[model samples]
Target: MIEETPQEVQVVEGVLLAHGIEPRTHWFEASTATALEAAAALGVDVGAIANSLVFRLDEEVIMIIASGAHRVDTHLLGEWLGGIVTRASADMVRRSTGQVVGGVSPVGHPERLRTLVDVSLGAYERVWVSAGHPHAVFPTTFEELLRLTGGTAALVARD
Candidate 1:
């Protein structure tokens, strides 16, 4: 287990606090690097785990908070956003969000990224999101997530 909160998680906590949210970050001894791992750790359904995915839409980086049970259809997303959506490289992800893949959060980026929250996430009353670290996560409702990230609600994933 981490002896202290990491700087990345602290930044996420700061963002949460700035938005009047009490950060209840959960740190795990084992790696919560995948949605399945996180869900197992939390004893929640996999669908309740929100996966923060970074994509390059043409020249701009965008974030999509998709449900763990779903996979994003990049072509569909591109049609909706009017750009070709491609999976971002690790370098691009780090440069854009200052967080690594499998640990990217909805907020706490160097700059506000255009974000979309998967509408299917609304099915869960409480959803767990990565708290800027592979071993950390936090709970939030779908509405709260949208408000926190200024994200639009959309069907970002394939059924």
Candidate 2:
């Protein structure tokens, strides 16, 4: 049975289902706001955490599904995406994804935004991503994310 989902998470769940992916959101008593926190809660490697990050690329808003183990290098990300990349403001984040900073998901936006998938995420068989709520998360695989978002696989971080 599916857990009772908040409206925000329901939007994400619908998107996942529309893509033919079925996943249940796990709600935690504590916050899963950060990748480290989420990984700890799930008892998984940090690399298995998929951080859905929003960025302002030139005039467009984009999403980068990065692995939790490393930080995304905005400079390199811009070069790869062929645009100037900068961190989206709180307002921009909310406006673009209709989700807060800590609860952004790879899908379920008002419109389809350009997305990039960090290649490092492929190292793990399954990854956990925000489920449109800070206290909620859902399981997915790298290939599924790529397929769902129609994202490009790229090296988004620096060592």
Candidate 3:
């Protein structure tokens, strides 16, 4: 297990503190890079794991916090956003969010990104999200996620 908190995760903790939230971070020995891994490590349903997805809309980068059980339909997302949506390159993801692909948190981006939170996540009372590290995660509610990321609630996933 990683005994030390990563600097990236510390930044996320700082952001959460700035938002008046006490960080409750969980670190795992194995990589919780994927939603399934995170769910397994946390002993929660897959749907309760919030997946932070980065996409490119024209020249802008956007974030979609979708439930682990769902897949973001890029075509539908593009239609809703009035532009085609493509997966953001790893470099773009890192530069825009100041974190690695597997560890991107909803907060602590270089700038405020346009974010969409999947309404499906509302089914769970508590959800787990990445805490800026592949081995770290934090529990949060759907409403809290919306508030923290300034994200609009939407149907971002495919059925």
Displacement of residue 155 (Cα, Å) in model 3 is 0.6
* 1-159 per-residue lDDT for model 3 (tens digits): 776777888889999999999999998989899999999998999999999989999888999999999999999999999999999999999999999999989988879999999999999999999999988999999999999999999998778
Off by over 4 Å in 2: 1-4
Per-candidate TM-score against the hidden true structure: 0.98, 0.95, 0.97
Tens-digit per-residue lDDT, 115-136, candidate 2: 9999999989999999998999
**Per-residue lDDT for 133 in model 3?**
92
Query: How much is 82 displaced in model 3, in angstroms?
Result: 0.5
Question: lDDT of each prediction vs. the true structure?
Answer: 0.94, 0.90, 0.93
**Sort order, TM-score high to low:** 1, 3, 2
Better of 1 and 3 by TM-score: 1
Better candidate by TM-score, 2 or 3: 3
Model 1: number of backbone collisions? 0
> Which is the winner by lDDT between candidate 1 and candidate 3?
1
Residue pairs clashing, model 3: none
Which model, 1 or 2, shows the larger lDDT? 1
- The ten-residue window of minimal lDDT in model 1 covers 150-159
Give the root-mean-square deviation of each candidate in angstroms.
0.7, 2.1, 0.8
- Which regions of candidate 1 fall more than 4 Å away from where they truly are? none
